[model samples]
Target chain A: MGLPKKGPTLLKKKKMEDDEEEIADLSPEVSDSEPESEPELESESELEDEDLKLAEPSKNAIYNTDGIIDKLGDISFPDNVGWIHRLSVDIDQEQEVDVNDDLARELAFYNQALEGTRKAFEKLQAMGLPFLRPSDYYAEMVKTDSHMEKVKGRLLAEKRRIEEAEERKKTREAKKLAKEVQAQKAKERAKQKKEGIESVKKWRKQRQQSGFAKDDDGGKEMDFSFEDGKAFERSGKKRPGVMPGDRSGGKMRQGGGKGKSQKKREFRNSKFGFGGRKGLKKQSTAEATNDFRDFKKGNVSGNKKRKR
Target chain B: MGKKRKHSETVASAPAKKDAPERPQRTILGWKDKNNTNNNEAQVTESTVGFKNKEKDNKVESKESKGATLNELVELKSCSSCLFFECRKQKDLYLWMAKCPNGPSVKFLVNAVHTMEELKLTGNHLQGSRPILTFSSNFDKNAHWKLLKEMITQIFGVPKEHRKSKPYHDHVFVFSIVDDHIWFRNYQISVPHNESIKIARGGLENSTLIEVGPRFCLNPIKIFGGSFGGPTLYENPFYISPNQIRAIEKKKKAGKYAKKVKAKTRRKVHELSNPLEPDEFADMWKE
Candidate 1:
């Protein structure tokens, strides 16, 4: 190609072509070949710009770290498998310390702190807090370890309280069950006592019904003694203590003997020639009156038959 | 003793005639004392005697006052003016009897009457028993078409222009003599199964005596004024087929012969088949 000699325009066109070539060669390796002093100068200005941006956010964010941590601790980890895996990945990426031993140790510490924080956060959430971000969480964690310690303490206290309540409930149920068993035993004892009384009365009645007079007297005596014996048995006392004739002047006195004056008095009361003879006088008088009426009627009828 | 007391109390409360002379007094009293103490037994005896007496009276009166039987009355009244009066006894009660000089007497019952006067017009006698008048091939052949047309026009009150343009033809006309009363099976020309249109038209053209097949026939005793226990006007099963009759007869004979051959083959095949046991066949067929 031949060069046209219009100097200023030609020089302008030549500079444009050279600038295009410089732009085309703007790769990182090519940039490295440039003077070290120039890059250092450019990087200083870029760093200044980045620092200015960082400082503005850090000033505002650093102050809100406690609040953010409190809020983040409130975020619940879902029990689902997918959510747990996602949470693990998220924590791993954010922490950025990747040596196995170091990661494991950090994970343990973080989990402990996270658990404490989560409990505190849940408490706070239950008290009604708003939405929080992950960055806010880490900032709060960095700001204070005391918050996590407080949460741990509260959890321990709650666990003890729940155990105590459960123990109390169990004891109360045991006592109520024992009372019911005792009442049932008492009812069974009462029923057995009633059955004993019925059998005694039946034995006494059968003894009196047959036509043996001497046997009847003996049976009444036996029945009185038997009833006393049963009463003693039911009371769990010795049988000899309940003898019917043990007391004097009682219905059946012991030894079959009476003092002279007592005998005379007994004789006067026995006018019908039987023991307790006075008790039958009224019954005998009624029978005598009935016999007299029948005799009078027979006499009149016999007189009329003689006349006929 | 308790039962005897109850019996005595019941007898004392019951109405009784002690001195009635119809029976031996001692025996009657003994019988009454034994059984009729209860009111229920007395009432049952009285009712039974009354019922028997009433039944005897009815029988005697029925014998004394003999009148025409219901069937006879129906026959007499229907046969009075009918052209087919000679066949009146064979016809069912209350059926309109039409006679053709050359053919069998056709008895059709009219269950209801629909007239031009009732419809408030003139020029028709749609006053037939059936809502839709089903004509036998004979009636369709012998009936005065002009008279039928006039009857339809007068009864239906169809306008002159509509009647003139839409003339009555071979197709059966089903009328709703009472509003929405008439029900017809395959009434339209577009019915897929009706082969009768061609048969009906042929009958109309031929002027020969035509008999309605059983499928086209209605119960004359049911539709017309027939008494209970009277004869039923049964439709003839045999229809006149004109040129097709011989063909139909041939087809029927062929069908009978085919059925006989099929039965014979079935019997021979059954006999020829092996009477092998089930278990033996099972092992023989197993892979």
Candidate 2:
């Protein structure tokens, strides 16, 4: 049982047989100046991941290249065998792939499969072999009909989820645009009212300069306070800090940030008043009960008390 | 979920093969697990058998990790090759691929197993079609890899004219080596074909593949010269057993309390050795 010493390993070691027996107590220090030594050194220095290889190939690890090649020769088919029998294709990997990156690794495998299939198909075509299954061909499939149905259901569910999300996004955008439009309309209304008030004032000044022409109603000028901005200003007495057209008045409807219909309903309710019991407010308070001035004044006369 | 019905149906289909032994009879063996409620082992074995079309099953229960007994079983069956799935502690799955009589077997730690029953892998193909074997270019870079590739081609590739095999090719198998682990993938090739005899002119170009999966990644641990035990051809230098990894993790978690206690004691000792100086400001504040 003699092994051939043909490679560069022969220059480094005296006998191949001795190298096999010297498997015990072997370390990285034993193998020096080989092509793989530098990389192994780096691995030794770095912290290894769970799946990553050791910093260096173990010194005792056997190569047995000759034995492997011999076995390969013994087991492999004769050269004369047709490609149809083996039905295998080897495709070149373009670059080194990072295993940790799942997408990239899967993509690399997919590319290899795709390329190999393409090549195999071309060869099959050249050989005039019927490789592709026809559309009508039906037989027992690897997966059951029920299993495929489940797969279809899952795919449809995912699509539905995405579509629902898109619909929500579209509605949100439309709502935002509608709000901007409403604000613009309100601003334009205010501007138009201001212009109308200015035009009336100018007309009155011109009439005064022309020497007032008396009308039948004692030459009185019509007051324009209501037409001016003064009429739109919020009254301080009724509800302090309330905007004129704000039906909620920034209090009752605190966080009901709803659409235009909500505001309309609120305004209608404020104008007509909400329908409920008004009897709770009729009861007198303790302060009213203890008031002596109103009691004495009320006792003086019924007409005077009613007037007060 | 019709799981029981599906199992019975698959079992009924198993005995459908009655063909001449033109191809090498590759046998699969596994230990029986009584507590396995999901019957995960049975499903995995059956699905693999179903995928390959006609694989003979010979259940052998052995605790030894060596392939010596497996080699004997292979020779007894007159099988040329074998795939022995050895499940340990009902957790780890170690796959052994061996040439029957003479030598060269590989031990792989199987991870990321997704069986065909999983609904995510949607594609389906003819049950008995011979898959086209495709290998990445790196398989030829080393001597051990080349040998493993030969074994895989023989074991996984259904014979040319086996009676159980379908007439047309409609699926492919991918054996790729990434990060020193061989990953296996199966895909169904779908082409838009209208004719019975011929594919449309650009059908090959238009054809797309859908994954018909039982995805697995195999990390090779050792290559033995004989079928199960012999002179070591190669050993993965970086390979660490899952048990060791688990033990390391447990130790790390277990050490946390001890570490906290040790730090407390050390702080106390330091405080005793060097007491804080009594400052004049203490008297001023007290007064």
Provide the lDDT at A153 for model 2: 94
lDDT of candidate 1 over B1-287, digit per residue (tens): 01111112111121334523221111000111122233322222222111110110111112211222322332323211111111112221122222111111223222122211111111111111011122112222212222222222222222111211122211113221111112111111111124334432222121111111001112222111122222222221211112233344456567788999999999889877956466756677567
| Candidate 1 residue lDDT tens string, A1-308 | 01111112111132333333322332345345434635553332222110011111112211223332332222212233221111111111233222223234223323332332333233334544321221112221111245335544655676799899999999999999999999998987777677667766766576566444558465554554336665345455444634644444333543344578678767776753655555675576766976765555445666776778
Among all candidates shown, the one with the greatest TM-score:
2
TM-score of chain A of each: 0.26, 0.55
Candidate 2 lDDT over residue span A1-308, tens digit each: 01111112112123223333222113345435434647555534233223334446666766788888877887676666667777899988889777555567667777777777888888888887778677777888888898889988987887799999999999999999999999999898788678667767875895688566644446355556555466555545676655656788766545455668788987998987777766755678898778877555435466776777
Q: What local lDDT does model 1 show for residue B213?
A: 9
Q: What is the TM-score of model 2 when looking only at chain B?
A: 0.82
lDDT of 2 by residue, B112-226 (tens): 6667777666678988788899999999999989998988887777766655678788888899987777888888787654443446345476667777877777888888877
Alpha-carbon DockQ of candidate 1: 0.00
Query: For model 2, which pairs clash?
Result: none
> Cα lDDT of model 2 overall?
0.67
Once model 1 is optimally superposed onto the true structure by TM-score, how far is the C-alpha of residue A39 displaced, in angstroms? 60
